[model samples]
Target: MNRIKTDWTKPQKLSLVALLFIIGKTIKESWVLILYFIVRAFVKQNEDEDDTEKRSDKLIYFLLLTAAFLIFFQIQKFIQFFKTRIYIKDNELIEQTGIFTKKTKTIPIHKIQSVHLVQNYIHRFTDTCTMKVETAGTEKTELELSAIDYLKAQDLQEILQQKEAVSAANISDNNSTQLMGLSNFDLIKLAISENHIRTLSLIFAFAMSRLDDLRQFFGKKTDAIIDEQVNQINFTTSIVAGMIGLGIAITLAFSVIRVLLRYNDMQLTANQKGFKVKWGFLQTQQKMMLQNKVQLISWNSNFVRKLLGIKILRFFMVGENILKDDQYIKLPVLQEDVLKKLSAYYQPVWPSLNENPNYTHPSYAWRVTMIYILPVAFAASVALYFWEPWVMIIPILLFLYFLVTFKIRHMKFIFWYNQTSLQIQKGIWGDEHILLNFKKVQHVALETSPFLRRKNLATLVLHTAGDSIKIPYIPLTKAQAIADRCLYEIELDKS
Candidate 1:
């Protein structure tokens, strides 16, 4: 095996990629100032004035000011890059940073929750990656090496993983087991089945935001430009249909391209220590998660994926929420057998819905309708009456939609628990399953409102390190018993 001969104990500077990273960071951080300068130079200019010399002088002054501002920031970042140093010693990761004011941070090795290696296009070209270290209880990345050697980053991550294993007292052998990998055909299938409507909505939202920005610059003239463009378009039924088809085609193409780039060459593996997922085409990312640190495991499938026999599996480690889709660890389960095998590794005994499962109270449907649908219906009735009475039909349709769906939603909801774990089955058209270990429950609470109290029902909430699960509108006695059992299991785990 080939190994790099760099000592991690001694302080070391970042890779040369840091120069590019620093430049990019400076530009991103100063974008608002850049925008302000551009707006001032354009909006404040007196184009109608005949005094050419005065305008020339003003332009020169603006150029010099912008140049000086950018130069100052560049110098500051350069100095910061030179001064920053990092090293691992005495079971702690230490970093020293800052140009004028010095600051240092130390994180214990055992406290690290995960180590992520990210390689964007620039880093890929330079054969480097960013190393992000996250510790338990921190809301954000605790330490980041903006640029480091890709191979060295993996070695350092393994070292940290070993330290975590020792702390947990559950070290395993050096054999890695491959859990999942995607082929080119599988990637095509995955891309084809993705929700293209969501992608189209995102694209439409971005276009609208850009239009608002244009409105700020052009004032009322922006609307004039839009109207002029619309007038120029020869809108026939065929043309309108062609445009809609073209838009759909473009959205699907974009989605396919995006999925291919982001999830190309994906692999998931597990060992005694933990799980590691590697994926990407241009910008590769590797996520390492410890076995014992994973607090919640969930698998959700939409209508399309359900037909394809696929589901997206997510692992929620300590201190992680619903982060950027790319940041959190997720895998596409292609088969039920694969999902069962992976589930067995994380949770030995996956609970099934009982023949007579604990369903929500009979009032669940009506209560959900009153809480969610009534307010919107009432607001729409008031607003639409003053605007367009005909539009009131929309709110009526929406109310009926929710009223029917909530009844099916309540029927679909099931909560099952055993001595060791809790299983929640939820959703209307699609199936979503969540598994939580009793030991992972950090807090349990029983909640009731006047309505619930009158019906002898309460809501039980179980809070874990990464996520929370709520069993709403259950019998008060059952809710209390569930809470007490969770607390007892947590205390037993401590012993």
Candidate 2:
């Protein structure tokens, strides 16, 4: 067993106080702004003011309000800092915080879902990181330790890991006769089935777009000069050359920055117990996932990434939402062959070979496409009454083409099931692969639209924790059978 004691430094405490002040100011000013607007609306005499007078008054009022809010918030923050102390004792984590309330929470090692060490530019400069520990719950009850030295952060992580191992062993010994385990091969399949490259490419493109926006905002003058130069290159050849040069420069800059920011010292490993991830540039983070805690798995690939042979894998754990953290354990980039091998371990239920099974949708796509087409065609017909009738032809043709694409895409859907899991694969341009444990399904629904009812076809939807997945175009009887089987499986698992 190991122990670590930690506290915030004076500067770090000031930073935390500043953060609280900002929050308080924002909240306080929000109500003030609303009230000021309402009061101003009644005082119409003041509306005829010179612009300079109005601006000056606004600035003075804002500064005064903010200063008062900050002064009060800083006092509250100082009291909080004086009261809080965090320390790890052997296999248990403890947080003793609060001024007048005097609250203390102790989380045993086994309950911690994940530990995250985060640092921004300021924290990096100070060689410290914020340690956050998540536990099992729907509420955002995270324990945060701010401004811990980098070496101390690493030492705490090791201590937590040791406690986790001991707790896991104890639980396994106690429950060995009752629990069913997911095999190492299953984890491997999960890793492989994820579309790593596609996911990475999408991530890269998004980062590049954001960076481009930031640059444009900060380098407005430089951008204006570049635009003038670009416009001056009037020759067709020179224009093409200029565009190509700009594109290449942007792409190279984006790629290097993205690789450095995201995958600096990236690592991924797996064991029979769980998956492990270590990544980051300034504040190295370690994330561990116990096999049983994983609730669902998904893989997604957009059209661009699919063309480039890339895919992204996502794991939904039992209690926490990955979207909140905005950090995912990634393979970074992987070849198709490597993906195939990893997919087998992570997503064994997915078919190894591409199966061109006939895909069918309930009448929903047709309804949606017709709904889209009717409006455009109606508008076009109305327009032709006043404008060129020829304009109608172009819109009519485009609408028809769009409708056809929707129909074709919606007609492509497939669902598969085995004794242990239900697999669903669907999408038009970007495919979505979902794997759900049959036991976790809360309920099953069989529904039919008017058209489907006429056709004697129905859809089956399985409801889980947060969302539901549907399988369409099955016969009514078959849909009922699937629903029944799912319900039985859920019951059996519970029993």
Candidate 3:
């Protein structure tokens, strides 16, 4: 095994600013605010002096203090940086570092599931990036290089992949063929199809919650101006129209910019190991997943995508996808051939209903989900009974909700088990297929309530390292059979 230390380059030093928001060390992170308070204290002490002279002195003192504190802080960071080290020995990736308390971490190279490089807005200014090293069985990164040279990070990533390749005997995809690449025109189409209202609502919520921070960063008082304008207007007359128009304009602008920058000229390629995607305009990222490392493969589509005949294929990788919520290896607006290629790489282990016609949820499964909705509906109707004409719309919505739930829950809620894998088909608005191999199953839970016990119905839950799959409203006998089979498969694999 070979070993090396970080170069500790100039860009890494500048990246300290980025770490202010990240890295939750209370004392070290609070330095800037501390410096501001110290300056304020110094200014307050000299309050007896003349106002003009005091103001000049305060400005000078604040600048001097800011410079001194930052200089000392950088020196401290430099010392810590110099002490930081990375090395490999005996099939282990070792990282040793810490300021006051030294910490050493040794991770088996084989256990390294995913290597991620993350860069946000601050990374643009620093010309450096973060290397997140995650392993199986954990949501947190095992080791993280917060600020490292971008090229060096890539070199390290290649080295890790090479090591993993040696271990798994699959380094890259053999075909080395381009799977999909989004052109500018395609990106434009994506921008048009995006659901701006939902995006805008998220933006509005975040902005409302973080107005002070945004004001400090962007130096725009328009938020205050808008608030004043809204308060001036009549509450019920045209507020909805005005807010919607503003939201639409903001959403459209944000959607266009976001699509162009985030998904600009994105490309996906397949090699011997698995597939890798390279995307982003200003700040580029390369995300790859190996077949062995992928725990799950799922896809989703909104109304726009369904209309456009496109889908986003998401990779539920074991070690690499630690974020859990956000998919790193996502192919957006996947064309036909790419979908076929993806399916070929990751086929469903579970057989379709055509192959196993007997294992399906009963018609009462529709009412299983309705059990959750009726209570809420009763409360809503009672709450809104005073609002007569307006309340009439609620029942219409309630009917639609029940109709959709009934249509989805009863018709396609199916699960089939074979010796190799279990297949689950679910979802209402979108088609979601889950294939769980026996080896990947972490645990199996077979549950039955009083009602389910009375009806001989049960719910089966299968947990993996990444996520859980639940099959609700199946016959108890079937649930028990599946659970026993899962345990039997686990024992077989072990033996």
Give all TM-scores, in the order shown.
0.87, 0.65, 0.75
lDDT (tens digit, per residue) of candidate 2 on 158-235? 556545755665333212111122233433333334345554576678878986887778776756776798788667
Worst 10 residues of 2 by lDDT: 173-182
Q: All models: lDDT? A: 0.84, 0.62, 0.69
Query: Per-residue lDDT tens digits of candidate 3, residues 1-495?
Result: 765644422222324543553444544656666677687678765455698787877777987787677667666555666667776677677777678889788888777776777666666567677777878756676776767766667666666666776688744434567878887778877887787877788898888878777777767776777689878978674878887788788898889887877788688776656666777777666665566666666666766777777677777777444355434565785576677577566664336634574344564545644676666777677677777757856865885688677776567666677666676776666566676676667789988778788888888898776667788778888788878887887787679
| Residue-by-residue lDDT tens digits, candidate 1, 1-495 | 966656778887878889987887777877776776788768865566669768777776886687678879689778877888888898888998896699889998878888999999888888889999887867688888889888778878887887788768567665888989998888887888788988899889999999999999989899999999999999999999999999989898988887888778889888878888899887789989887788889999888888888888988888875665644866888988888878776777766744246899979877778887889898998899889998888988899888888898899899887777888899988889999888889999999999999999999999998889999999998898889889999889889
Q: Against the correct fold, how does model 2 do in TM-score? A: 0.65
lDDT of 1: 0.84
The better candidate by lDDT, 1 or 2, is 1
RMSD (Å) per prediction: 4.0, 9.9, 6.4
| Highest-lDDT candidate | 1
List ranges where model 2 is wrong by over 4 Å.
1-69, 87-93, 105-112, 121-127, 139-141, 149-237, 244-248, 282-284, 319-330, 336-358, 362-365, 375-385, 388-394
Clashes of each: 0, 25, 8
Candidates ranked by TM-score, best first? 1, 3, 2
